[model samples]
Target: MKKGENTRKHIISKAAELFNQKGYAGSSMSDITELTGIKKGGIYRHFASKDEIALEAYNYAGSIVGGHIQEAIRQQETAFGKLLSYLRVYVNVVEEPPFIGGCPLLNAAVECDDGHPILRQRAQQGLEGTLGNIKAIIMQGIESGEFKADIDVDALATFTLSIMEGSVMMSKLEGDNRHVRMNIENFSAYLRAVCVQN
Candidate 1:
């Protein structure tokens, strides 16, 4: 990468960790500069404003997490396996988060809920893509005869995301991956029994 583009990405990477952990509202330009070891002028030179930096950081964080999950899911051989692999990512995230704070989507969604319309929209768009991936996996299972044809794809996808996100939250709070592991295992087994083919 060019020197300028490299500097821009460096700012985004550091800011993403800061904003993900401290939140956009909580993190300030001072904090960003301290974390990135760059002067305010240096940062502003690359980003028009803090908002621009935050948006780029959010996108970077999302892609980091998404790529991790997508790579894992791709390793699976069947649609049912892919669905289980998808849920398993959260279990891994409980301890080894792709970013410093945690799940960027969850953090952004909660932090942006009442304010930061642009960031909230970014979170929403990221979540829709996530849910859409789940639905697509379910549809693939049905088409491949790997999953029961009668499954309600929409409801299952929504429920899966909700429960998985909730589990991650609990795990983060307690500083233990056991809760997430149990939840993922039980849910995966349940789906295997009822949804997956014999």
Candidate 2:
């Protein structure tokens, strides 16, 4: 890659780690400079401000989690397996640190709040996109007669996401992964229960 492109990518990558660990408000320009071993003015050449870096970091972290789910779904043969796979993916993700802190999107939601509108919107969009993917898979199951026709795909999708997010928050705050595991299991059980055929 070109020198400038490499520098920009490096800044975004290092900034993502700091933002994920310290959050937007907690991460300062000097912190990023120290971590990256780059001067503050050097960072400015790549990013206008901390907010710009935060937005990019949020997007960068979000892409990692989103890509995992999408890959899991793509690998499954049926919608039944896909939904289960999605939940399983969440289970595995939470067991790992950083992710164990929960989803970047959820973290960004609470961190950004009213202070950063762009970051907040990115979080919202990330969540909405995740829900939509789940809803689509549920709809597919319904069409294939695997899931009950009466199942409200949208409602169930939202509920499933809510449980995961809530459990993640609890796990992070409590410094335990048990709640997250239990929550994912509950989601899996619910999926099996709602299916037309076992």
Candidate 3:
């Protein structure tokens, strides 16, 4: 890549790690300069302010997490397979996180809530996109006769999202992967319960 472009990418990447781990408000321009090893003027030349960096960093972090789910689900033909693949991403994340910190959406939601409006919106956008993907899969199953016709699409999708994100929070809090494994098992059974069963 070109020099400026490479620098911009590096700043976003390192800033993503800093903001994600340190929280947006918790991180400062000097902190970014220090972490990025870029001078204040050098950083300013690339980004207008910390707000711009936070937005870009969140998007950068979000793309990694979102890309994994989309990529995994795309590998499956059936809705159940797709859904299972989505769950597996969470399980896989316990071992291989998508980025420097854990799930950006989860971290952003927690850190950005009630403040940091831009980051909050970005996180919300990421979540809505994910929920839409999950709901679309459920809808596809309904149309394809894979899932039950009477399945509560929104409820199931919401439950799956809650389970995934909540389990991630608990697992991270306790520093244990078993929480994810156990939740994945129960959620997997829940998925089976919603299927046509024949």
Candidate 4:
């Protein structure tokens, strides 16, 4: 990458960390500048405003978490395994220090609310993609006779997402991953309950 691109990425990465920790409204350009060790002019050269930086940061964070889950789901051959992989990846993320910041989409969604239109939209898109992936796995399971036909995949996906995000939020707020693990266990239970006998 060019020097300019590298600097821009550096700014976005640092901004993402800050935005994840302190939130959009709570974060400032000065914070980004200080954390990235980039001067004000350098920051302005990359991003027009803090809002733009926050939006890009939020998008980057979402992509990071979402991509991890997608890869995990795709790697498993069976629907049951995929579901388990989906839930397990979160636990793994929590175990890893880097992704331990919790769900970035959840963090941005909660922080943005109705305030940040662009960031909120990106967050919503990220969540919709997540829920859709889970729902697809459930649908595949049902089609394969591994899950009951009567199961509400959409509702189950939504519920599972809620539980997962909630658990991550709680765990991060409390500085522990125990709650996240418990929530993943509960998701596994929910999956088993919905799965049909082969």
lDDT by candidate, in order shown: 0.86, 0.78, 0.83, 0.78
Candidate 2 backbone overlaps, count: 0
The residue-by-residue lDDT of candidate 3 on 1-198, one tens digit each, is: 899999999999999999878888889888988988999999989989889988899899888877887888889999888876656777745567666677888899999899888888888898898889889999999999888898888898888888888877787777777777888788778778656446
Tens-digit lDDT string for candidate 1 (1-198): 899899999999999999988899999999989988899999989989999998999999999988878998899978766776655777766558766788899999999998999989989999999999999999998998988999999988887788778878888888888777888788887888878878
Segments of candidate 3 deviating more than 4 angstroms = 92-95
Which is the winner by lDDT between candidate 1 and candidate 3? 1
Query: Candidate 2, overall lDDT?
Result: 0.78
What lDDT does model 3 reach? Answer: 0.83
**Over the stretch 28-117, how does candidate 2's per-residue lDDT look in tens digits?**
888898988889888889888888888887777777777777787789988867766655665544457434245787788888889889
Among all windows of 10 consecutive residues in model 4, the one with the lowest summed lDDT is 92-101
Report the Cα lDDT for residue 67, model 2.
78
Cα RMSDs of all predictions? 1.3, 2.0, 1.5, 2.0
Candidate 1 ranges beyond 4 A from true positions:
none
Give the alpha carbon lDDT tens digit for every residue of 22-125 in model 4. 88888878888899999999899988888888878877887777677778777888877787665566664555733536678878889888888888888888
Write the number of the candidate with greater lDDT, choosing between 2 and 3: 3
Q: Estimate each model's TM-score.
A: 0.95, 0.90, 0.93, 0.90
Which one is best on lDDT?
A: 1
Candidate 4: stretches off by over 4 Å: 92-100
